[model samples]
Target: MKIFKRTKIKKYSKDGRILFTKEMKKEYTILIPMMLPIHFKFMKNILVKHGYKAELLNTSHSRIIEEGLQNVHNDTCYPALLVIGQLLDAIKSRKYDEDKLALIITQTGGGCRASNYIYLLRKALKKNKLEHIPVISFNLNGMEKNPGFMIRPSLLVQFVYATLYGDILMLLSNQVRPYEINPGETDRIVDKWVIKLSNELNGKSFFSKRNIKRNMEQIAADFAHIPVKKVDKIQVGIVGEIYMKYSPLGKNSLEELLAQEDAEVHIPGLMDFIIYTCDNRITDTKLYGINIIASFLAALLKNYLIRMQNMLIDAVKTQYIFKAPSSFDHIKSLVKGYIGTGVKMGEGWLLTAEMLELINSGIENIICTQPFGCLPNHISGKGMIRKIKERHQNANIVAIDYDSGATKINQENRIKLMLSTARLNLLKAADDSEAFLDNAQTR
Candidate 1:
């Protein structure tokens, strides 16, 4: 009568780190946070094709910010705050089956705070007692293991092609959309390609090297033919931290604002950043004792990406006036003394190189954006400004800080002031051109 049977107790994760289950394969949908709408739309297709219901949380409304503030620390980085907020807002929206819903966040597995966002997101999910949901860290580093969404060779190759496709799409769209004869025609062409490429990738063996090359050439020709109404619009180059440089929300809709003011926007391809991060592993091995195999692999992968990028750039050059971006090594050489590869704080010397690339390409007006109190940005961006300006006299560089408290009007006002100076110079140059032609005619 005194002997009692022992009971086994199971412990559940309170931090939303639950492993994705087999049942989730049937009904659960994966929610991915969006940085660029076009890129994520294509990426979403790839995920869905791979036997998962993947959706992009593409909203950038106030509600997202509100949800993020409630769950995430205010002093944390803005991109993380926005991303967490968007996901939490969706969770609390009462639209999805909570038990069948999981989240996928990109974990760079880097030295930056960005790599910790998955943990932050998990803590938030747990606080709301939604820890039963799975969190997948999307990365190539193989740092953190997830039972769900392993990257097979085919899947990995598809993703690399997706990145290359997104770059070409973004490059063509940004350059063409601003100067198109018919409003939204460029966007329509982009949407057409998005659907076409998604369908093409759905079939096995569709991502052949020959097919990829053909796709790039066709896309370049398609966008190049978009009837552009040429005007004396200011060409502005945007260089910033990875998030702010690309994410519309992270920069408070900076590209839209620039477009509204009739400025041609140029952003370096996302592939460069991917290559830069991979190259960092090699740099680390040299400086900090990673394995030789890892270093060799990193270098090999870096070179492969360059070949892909060069193919895309060559395709575009064949059809359009667009200038191809320099290789990673070329970018590094631009600021070799000013900053080093190991200075990899928030974009580090890459930010400096982008600015120089813009100036050399004749896009003299530049906007260097950063989150307020981002020390890496302060060190790499603002620190090297004077030298950049010293080298290029015509460079009109303005560094803008973005934060929760920063006003859109304030940021736009600063840009408007810069544009005012730019317009005057443009007009002066026009007058000089006419005068020189008249003198030549008289002679």
Candidate 2:
């Protein structure tokens, strides 16, 4: 006779939030929500390199929203609803073993609803009887701790470099994609670099400054070499809540739609947002007399990130075909009169700064996307627009609110109207230039 012993299953906690134990790290697959596709792809690769089996959820289906609305309150921030829904949708699909899975969500540890999403997700999981699956909060601040996952110094460095690389690739690709003589050439280059960079990040030269510079230069050069048509196109800039600005799923593929409308899209890179967050830490100390030690460390991190950004800019400057993003200092300076640095809720003053930065850079047409009922974004993003237009008369800005109920057709119609106005401005400018030339010739 053989005796069999059954393994014990842990009971749920009162709050349904369970800690991911170290033993779970071996068998659990962590699922990450997709935001900035290229960036998340690199981030996922970094996690795999560090011995975590990770997957970036890129599923864009109606059910994701449905699940979110069902789980979360409809009046909550749209981003919270969508993110929760996406995670739940994946779990219900039963593709992975429910007991052997974990979900990771980033927390800014700010005053925004984003910080509360992890708790909301846990509640939703409990509602669906899936509370056994642990949720990991991936944040720089010590907001939450997990035994299974830890971001060591080496891993953090790789993630930072990954972001820098992703930003450069996204910037250059956006510049060339609309103008490429051969369709798909720009994307092919992007795909190639993503894989090469992922492999290099796992190798010995990952931390080598020389190798990093060489990679950036090569990426810029490759994009520059792509055959492009020299035709005028509407230059549109996107600025708003972090997720809505970058996530194709969040904004209904705003970038792709702009390309179809014969427009060049310029999005402020993720590095700027990261830098802004660090700057806020310093701002807190100055404005509210917070801990000076934390402020000092924040300054150090901010400067380091600025140096990395400068390296990217230098590489892009070497290629005359692409226009690199402005430095953080330049972007920060633009918000001088419009908003104060002390406004640190949600996107805060950074949203206003990005809008001003876009207008000053000849990208006068802008789309400020935000979740419906998100008060902070409204105050900083849409509220600052009129003031910006008052100063820069040429600035054309449209604020779009994205919620589950917001129809795609209505949104597209509004954008099409904005595009019409942009076209008129372009034509008027060209005519004015010709008249000036004629007058000079007559003189």
Q: Number of clashing residue pairs in every model?
A: 0, 0
State the lDDT of candidate 2 residue by residue for 263-343, as single tens digits. Answer: 999988999989988999899999989979989999999999999999999999999878888999999998998899999
- Cα deviation at 80, candidate 1, in Å, is 0.9
Superposed by TM-score, candidate 2 places the C-alpha of residue 226 at a distance from the truth, in angstroms, of 0.5
Off by over 4 Å in 1: 1-16
RMSD of each: 4.1, 2.4
lDDT computed for candidate 2: 0.90
RMSD of 1: 4.1
TM-score of each: 0.93, 0.96
lDDT per model, in order? Answer: 0.82, 0.90
lDDT of 1: 0.82
lDDT of 1 by residue, 280-369 (tens): 888889898876798899999999998998888788888747766676678878886677778886687789888988888888988888
Residue 266 in model 2: shift from native, Å?
A: 0.5
> How far is 182's C-alpha from truth in model 2 (Å)?
1.1
